[model samples]
Target: MTRIFIQDKATFKTTARTYDDAGFLHVPGRVSKTGTQQYLRRELGLDGDPNARVTVYRPPEEVFAADSLASFDGADVTVMHPGELVNAKNYRKTSVGLIRGPGQQDGDFVKADLVVKDADAIAAIEKRGFVELSAGYTAEYEHSPGTTDDGTEYEYVQRGIRINHAALLPAGAARAGRQARLYDHQPKGSTMSKITLDSGRSVEVQDEATAALVQDHIDRLQKQVTDAQAELDKRQATIDGQAEQITKLQAATADDQITARLKAVTDARARAEKIAPGVTFDSIDPVEIQRQALAKARPSTDWAAKSEAYVQAAFDMAFDQVETTDAHADQKRKLAEDGAKVVTDKAKMPAYDSYTARFTQPQAKE
Candidate 1:
């Protein structure tokens, strides 16, 4: 079996020194019999004490290797166009400053001897349409630090995956420490296995593995949501612009002395058409629809353009909304599948309290 070695680094997580916060240090000072009696009174009080303290904790044994972001797929950057050159200053040690990632230079992701594939990918993106910036690649393994004060070690090895698109992002190592979403990651497609080491240190790549899967899925769903919302927002903005055009036309045409209403209405309608060709209103009456020639003769020259434009915009907006709704509905369905899988798992059988979907409301007729 090919072994992936990573260095054993100390992961002594910071504690807020809450236990030693008080100036006095005594055997029973922090938690005494007297304190327990008062605590019991407070906890068992008929009305809960609003100011009472509560604590939850996990023992040190539960603290696994968790210090840095687990490198799932070593990132790859691809230059899309012919001349596209991703500035690789960060990859260069002189440029990385503090951030580190795959294909990085002086900081050491890619070997100095090898001009890793990333440099070429960036060259592609700089010229034409988007190029494949990066692709997932193998990871360089490092060892886990021993659980205690004594040192433990492992070497880093390669797992294959690369991510490109470096120019779009000036820095790496992810700017998401404090911004990381709290999640219980499911492990899959990881470089390492759930191996146990000596010194009571587990060799499982829990953080990296779990973070990778969870992050992938989270990014996928979030991207979908973001894209849909952006599209809607863009469409709405277009409609707003068109509405403003109508208002301008209305104001200009209202001037009887200038007889500008005809010109204003005509131009406004055209502008609306150009702005939002997806809106649809119940503005089309059968009586009005029959006057094809008369409709053409209508004083508003741009009426057809504007009316159809607004209608198209409205309809397209609704269509996109439905598209988004269906996507979310699909997500809910997938979540349900995962939920069912969890419910069936004998290990988690006891924890199956409830499983729900986003769109769970049964139709009224049904």
Candidate 2:
């Protein structure tokens, strides 16, 4: 069974009209006002054969009626060509006319007489096998829940339409069928389900398995994102831990440097005490002693020897201040002269029998 679905507006091919030289043709606009049995059974709320064929024509009684020759009321009934109204002068008559066809009831027809001004336009309509009609109407939709022969749960429904106006369209110009398929309320053909959006649009679902596959792909991508975020968090934690360890190591290194410096100062003070026995090095700050030792200790040199030399020089300078005897004074003068060798070409040791010998000679008593 070929099940054809329709939307709110549906279009179908109708009997073509022969072009007359008088610019008029008596063609059937609609054969049955209640529609055919096929439409009534399958889509409408009437009992009829689903395999029956339907056509558009006029009934005989309405055409032969007493009031048949009335003036064409172009006011209520509009004659349109391809969804557009014809010129007022082009329209001749619009009323019911007899159409010789099978199963046509009394007054169950619509007919129109239109004057074709353009010969080419009328010839084009003859070339095509069908004409089209558009009607405006409201419908009361009904849903009859039932199961198919294969036990598939389904619903059969129909629309009780009350048409207002039917406009004649040119051949192959009607968009109602395509528009119905796209914006239809019912899912026809092989479509099994529909997804209605919040914006009042419906989407037909043809393949359920494909939709499931797409959903699975989305879930997997979400999981991968979660895993990537977790990995990033783990890496950040490792970096934080490494930074903390580096800070602690730096603090420990600073403390070790301070301890080593303090030890060097204490050792330097002890050596200074030994070099100058009578001098009191207790008043000197330990930091200052450390600074002095650090200033003298050069790379690739003997630090012990350099420290002893520096202590001995300090001792000599302090011992020279306390000397009172001439020998001690002479020793002090020799040491001062020896220290001046770098700045002046002076004797290494001054020649002096006593402290007075080192002084300037007095003038001879003549």
TM-score of each: 0.20, 0.21
Q: Report the Cα lDDT for candidate 1.
A: 0.31
Compose the digit string of candidate 2's lDDT tens values, residues 324-366: 4446879989999887875464333354334446465675678
Instruction: Using TM-score, give the best candidate's number.
Output: 2
User: In model 2, where do residues sit more than 4 Å from their true spots?
Assistant: 1-22, 29-124, 127-130, 147-156, 169-366
Worst 10 residues of 1 by lDDT: 28-37
Q: Residue 174 in candidate 1 has what lDDT?
A: 27
Q: What does the lDDT read for residue 163 in candidate 1?
A: 24
Error of 1 at 267 (Å): 24
- What would the per-residue lDDT of candidate 1 be over residues 174-281, giving only the tens digit for each residue? 222111111112333324434333334554554543433444345445655786899999999999999999998877567572465455444444433433343232
Would you give me the overall lDDT of model 2? 0.40
Off by over 4 Å in 1: 1-207, 255-366
